[model samples]
Target: MESPLEPLLDGRTKGFPAAAGLLRLGQVGSMGWNVLAEDLPLPLAVLKETALRHNSAWMRAFQDLTGVALAPHGKTSMSPQLFRRQLDDGAWGITVATVQQLRVCRAYGVTRVLMANQLVGRQAITYVLDELARNPTFVFYALADSVAAVDALAAAAAVRRPGRSLDLLVECGVNGGRAGCRSLAAALAVARRIKAAEPYLRLAGVEGYEGSVPGPTPDQQERRIAEFVGFVGEVAECCADEGLFGADPVILSAGGSAYFDMVTSLPRQLGPRATQVVIRSGCYLTHDSDAYARAAVRMRERTPAIASLGEGLRDALEVWSYVQSTPEAGLAILTMGKRDVSHDLHLPYARVALRPGRDARPRQLPPDCEVTALNDQHAYLRTTEGADLAVGDMIGCAISHPCTTFDKWRFLPIVDDDYDVVDAVATYF
Candidate 1:
């Protein structure tokens, strides 16, 4: 049987073997394509099948240990295939940042979606309302930090009359942070506004993004995160006290890729409010090598519970590029650049390398070998003295931020430990 994703596999798709013409997505494994064997093109982004499964299971265990639900941010991969994997692994719902992402989830038969961002604009608002009216089982929640946003959503919901109330989470934020009310009083105001909107707009719960809260030191950051999460809980409690929350299990949603350990304390803070704590840690599915990895180490130190849980998330994503140029003695230019992998948080790290003919397996890149810079189509890999790297050698780099890397490719191959292509996932954005 032809796989539903077969249409996405063709000659034009990046990372796919160009000579293999119009193969079905399901037949990728049978093609015997191996990255080390040079069956596919260079600068290909692939997901390690083993690592992917490990990361998914690890997150499931974390959720079970913490007793907090996960609505992993969909913006991380934007791939419906991965969303299915997370849902099947027991995710509470998929979290999105925009109406477009929510649309993708809805199209793929995702019944529950939480838009962590405020729902604005005529077209975006109309789309959500249309989806709600069209599907009786569709459950949606969006953030609102101000009365203006609440009024706009209420106006749209009133006009559309989707026959169901538009659930909203009053966002609480800190100064100098991203969207959300900057003060507890402000958050209560938004919650009250959402409550006043009545049948049109429902104050389902309170939400915030602790990742944006700044601190100069790790301890300071963790302290601020705890304080910010406390504020989010306070908003939920105030809403409950005022009879503002419309949902039966008031949702207290927060937690970005970092600080989920602290965000999990929301349930404890709420005590017995009949609250549902949802952590939106999107990058946990395909853990990164840089920023997130460092954060994980700190997470274990602060939260002993996470430390007790065997091994944490492993890096599942990698971009393989060939040594295209050996321009200088200390530098090797790689085929992958800003267009292929993520360079937002940190430059991609050279993890492993395999020479075309000489090396039987991939060897660890020298500890000193670092990605110093990247251009539109090339990476400047700075190698230590006497590092055995040459043109045509395959270099696999682990990215820092999975969110930016996943957006660069429409389709990414899922490969086994030996780099054999086992499956493929298509990204919506």
Candidate 2:
């Protein structure tokens, strides 16, 4: 069978370069100009259909293999369309990192949530309590580390004790990372504080993040991640020993995209406990060609059952830019700037140079075409070979990390196999 993409071009140009020709004709006693559509908003990105489905299936399969319910972090891709697909795939819930993110998820019909971060401030507390009241069955779990955080949640919910109670998880931390109780003793102390202030807040489970911890080597990294997961298990047992949670299930949630393999195996260390393990990996959605690509390879070697997640998750996001100038013989200036794709992790990868309005497939550029530098609105690309790309040629760049790229566009158009726009996805932040 022929791939849908081939015929959709329909003799049209396979790749876009510079505008080919312009025609002027007079009709109905009027003179008008016809020019090829060469220019588009530069550095545009898209989510490829192939990669999207691959990531979705990979995460679900990972959950099935590990026996851990997936509550994939929603902060990675704020697209509600992605969230709906996850729910359909048997995800227990979606995990978010902020009050605003929860609002966006709730608005989009995500029934269960894990704030995954500390829910602070009266405004944030009020928003969470109100969400619980509005949707009685809607479950939300926030991180509680310090007494201040637990107190604020309890104080806010105290007003509506007759309504829903705030579900919470004690966040475990190692010395230098972000928010979490450093010691198991400290976590228990915080849980005690929450119990002391009942009816307002309830200790539901234990959660931690492994993304922040650094590993000296692959072996060292694995050891640290395993220890972190083990600590989360200990907290779960503590809650069980103390008989804190009544009818509700105790959550032993922790795992980011990079170290989920280590976290999911935590149950082996806990031994015969009935606690539910929830892996909150979000970046599995739009796996990058750079940072996440390397991590996925490692995960494949370690966990074979869910190895499909690492299979051909294309760098679907592309930045389309025009060559503005050829400077100093070896350099070309692009119309895209820093206001476009993220440069914090790394620069964008140049995929192809589309000729203007012409229909021939794009020939691969020489190895010298490098994304050398970026400014506010222009990207400096250095090239030594490949058909002297003149001014006005379109270049499609593959991105690295997707979290930063998503916020650049308010609305993203989804194209089908034929490259024809099919649907539009909106983002909250």
Candidate 3:
């Protein structure tokens, strides 16, 4: 298991073996050890290879079925290995949120990247232009939600005006949402402004995020998301009709792991233009147990085929820890906590419990088991069935909100179905 990422998984990394160079990242824990054998320390993050492959293929097939391309947002697992896998599996391009992430992608030999956010500072513009110039075949795109942003991007691109215009997309935003233009008029103006920039900036397409569309309930949210995505489609058509696009095969993208069904369904009437519709869904690469899990059900409800495909997306990421204490009858303290896993949307759910030689295989958690609370480095787990209670026992916990969980681990081990370490992946940030 002495892989290229061995240096990053040494003793310096959290939860790694304390003895430097004692074990490589992918080697079976020391002395033919397995997860159930407690060969590694507690609070270890592991990715199920089977689930990872399933989610990746599921998302790609979903995109192919909808007749769109995937530029999976790389911010979810900033792992170059995952990016390469996605690209190799037929991803059109990789999408990033910041210039720093852009650097990471480029460093890993990503030729095409879509910066899904606005390019603001002068240094960022210069870096992008310089990188573009360094590689003639490079295809990079940024978002522009306002005339001021377009102007700033234009001025910054002028620093390297190397006979090529910077590619950009007019971002359409919703009321009280994140970045982007709140009105069609405003977005259209931004597109026109990009066209006005002429040789310095190129209006390539339109961008939007349907994940946070406001609605009172699930049905209402889905309906409103459909409407908002339709608005983005209208904006794309408007930009195309007005001759605002700088080139052919315009890009129209709007998907954020949630409500991608709406993004694909509502934009079917894109005027039959030569456009490559892309969905920027990153979390589907490692589907979680909450938030996105509910969305997946909705996605399957909207499209029944996805549900029949290997249970949609299985939960891939898990944090394995041991029961540290059971001071109370129903409450037990786990070694894992906020520092070890994610608790943004929902707390971790117990999946399996093992007692070394006593159990031949991992067992599912009792129906009454639950992770109630978490401190900086402790998890308070409660179980109604007293038989499931004990200290020094191993438990595998499935995480929610994968985005928040990934940023906490720099190096994650990839394990097979039996939880044996097979390979490893390193995250940049």
RMSD of each: 1.8, 8.2, 2.4
Model 3, position 96, has a per-residue lDDT of: 99
Q: Which regions of candidate 1 are displaced past 4 Å?
A: 1-6, 268-272
> All models: lDDT?
0.88, 0.72, 0.83
Q: Can you write out model 2's per-residue Cα lDDT over 62-168, one digit (the tens) per residue? A: 67667888898888778777787778888889999888898888877788999899988778877888878878879888899998877777777887553866878
Per-residue lDDT for 1-429 in model 3, tens only? 333334346677765656545555545333353566665677889888999888888877787678888999999999888898899999999999999999989888899999999998877888998888888888999999989998888887777875688999999889867888888899999999999998999998899998778888889888888888888988988887788887568888988888776677545444555787888989988888888898887888877766556568888999999899989888889998999898889999987888766888888888679999999999998877654758888888988988888898877877788777777778888
Model 1, C-alpha of 46: deviation from truth (Å)? 0.9
Of the pair 2 and 3, which is ahead by TM-score?
3
Q: What is the lDDT of candidate 1?
A: 0.88
Assess the local accuracy of residue 409 in candidate 2 as a C-alpha lDDT between 0 and 100: 60
Query: In model 3, how large is the Cα lDDT of residue 128?
Result: 94
Would you estimate the TM-scores of all the predictions? 0.96, 0.86, 0.94
Ranking by TM-score: 1, 3, 2
What is the number of residue pairs that collide in model 3?
0
